[model samples]
Target: MAAGAIPATKLAYFDNMWAVQATATLLSHLETEDGRRALILDSTIFHPQGGGQPADTGFISGAASGFKFVVEDARLKDGLVYHYGSFENPQDDCVSIAKEGEEVSLYINPQRRDLNSRLHSAGHLLDICIRKMGLSHLEPGKGYHFSDGPFVEYKGIIPPDLLQIKSKELEKEANALILAGGKVSAPVLSYNEAAECCGGVLPSYIPTDSAPRIVKLGEHPGCPCGGTHVADIADIRNLTADAPHTNGMP
Candidate 1:
């Protein structure tokens, strides 16, 4: 460690709730070999690539300037948040850079964020529905919440005869929750409290005494998570589920 250096990026998106437009201080910068220059922020409203969701892309500019930099990616590393993108530099067009410690405004692409959020939330809701199906034995696992083709993987096998029935039931329950307009109610809780919300079984990666971020749909039980989400259940539209392959999911 340095004699005196900040250890990592302070995250703001956790408390941002739903901030599409915000501001932060430029903490540092990096230029990748691919030619993309990434700006690190002291505190960020950007959601980094973690929790099975993709990073958020947006723009970072001087507090009052027209357009200083275009942020293309946000990532979390060792507690630091990196915003990767380019800017229109006044000095030259070849490269764009920002001074560290300068105040900068940030904005996330609304359309992209909306889709990502909805799908991510849908994945969570699907997990809950799976439990409701009396097949909790399936055991939830990895989730691909990307907008292109999102799905939740489970550890147990579904009897081949129940595939179609299960798929249809999943769609119906997921969509029912959407139409029901369940209010979102995610809150951070102490380790014990969080564990209880997750049915008293925290994921293996979570320490027994570590506080965790949780997400819940309306009155449903909350699950620990770290991804942006739609404000309400209704925000997720046209959610569908595909039948598990005979060979099972990857």
Candidate 2:
């Protein structure tokens, strides 16, 4: 409950997006102010909801007691990952089923993870298509990769005349690249290396001295990201892009 009580969780997903199961040491099991149970682990494969991607849902079971905790949602706050869910069978007295320092096995829903990874990867591919189509002026902005209706927003405006044509072209180019296929990679690099990989510039928000994880799709330029992605571009299978719209950019 204290601010510094637990250290930042090690992100296992960052290194291997395809891993569906992993083992971790239980750090703390607490009930939130809202009465929801939260599990903290020293390392986690669960991807939290952020950066336009939804949180992963799965289950964590204690190896010793066989107690199961259903992870309805996961969130990251102040560098700690909170696995929010209720245990399959809470003790009658309300004592936590998981104990500190106990080893637990995490099993993420593979179907959900696969879909999320594909949607997230498709967004990056769309960015590549935008640049390749010579719409580089439309600076990338927020991205919503939810399954309901995934779309990437841009900071700049497109001319009324080109809106329809550009959207079609973007969709065409994206599918073409997906068909051709290319290996996808995300590697941690020094600030300078990351900047070089990202066309000689890193976003201002990234710390100057910190090594950032850069995701690259084949020969296309890399970008700094802190999310999971597919192993190859072709894994996306197909993609469609709608005409870009603006909220209030003039």
Candidate 3:
């Protein structure tokens, strides 16, 4: 009802990542430096930029008055998700007027969402592919799953002599799993159950007594993730490789 008032933004994307459109109530709105603006929604289907995934770009329209808000990015500060955009009323002259407690429709750009999800899912699948190439001890370190040029880093570097061969092998294996079309699952579980779903492994930051969200891609290993992912591996038909590169061996 007011700017800076934290509202629990129900991220429907977590409930069903496949949803691209949703109706939301405008809980609040704020104007930043130089008139930049943002709207806070009670519940949104948009995934805010975080966890290496780019923010969702979309538009919101007033359900009744038909005013348009061109949303360029979604962000999170504290526990609230902000839909950042330009607000306009083409037919009216209300300066900086988006009413509080108004009904709005959110439309997430499907192409961007699909591409980002594919690339991100591929990054995880790449880890499995690498391990399949007989590098079992290599732990996942960092990842760059942006659509531009996605790559996942491991704790140790692979031999230069094997880079070309291994990358190609990894690509082949990853694509095979993609083609196999296994179900991608996101489930919440207690730490022990989460660990069991993920091959009895829990990341150091995950509290043992807390429930963790897990993503399982087919029969391959599952991991804790908050990023949006495709519902099926088949959605990612082509997960290519550009050779495995890494930081200096540790």
Best TM-score among the predictions, by candidate number: 2
Q: Which pairs clash in the backbone of model 3?
A: none
The estimated TM-scores of all candidates read: 0.90, 0.95, 0.91
Better candidate by TM-score, 1 or 3: 3
lDDT tens readout by residue for model 2, 115-219: 999999999999899899888998888999899999888878788777778888989999999999999999999999999999999989999989999999989
Q: Which lDDT value does model 3 have at 249?
A: 25
CA lDDT scores, all candidates in order: 0.78, 0.89, 0.81
| Every model: Cα RMSD to truth | 2.7, 1.9, 2.4
Error of 3 at 27 (Å): 0.6
Q: Which regions in candidate 2 have their CA more than 4 angstroms from the true location?
A: 1-3, 247-250
Q: Could you say which candidate leads in lDDT?
A: 2
Report how far off residue 161 is in candidate 2 (Å).
Answer: 2.6
Candidate 1 structure lDDT: 0.78
**What TM-score does candidate 1 get on C-alpha atoms?**
0.90
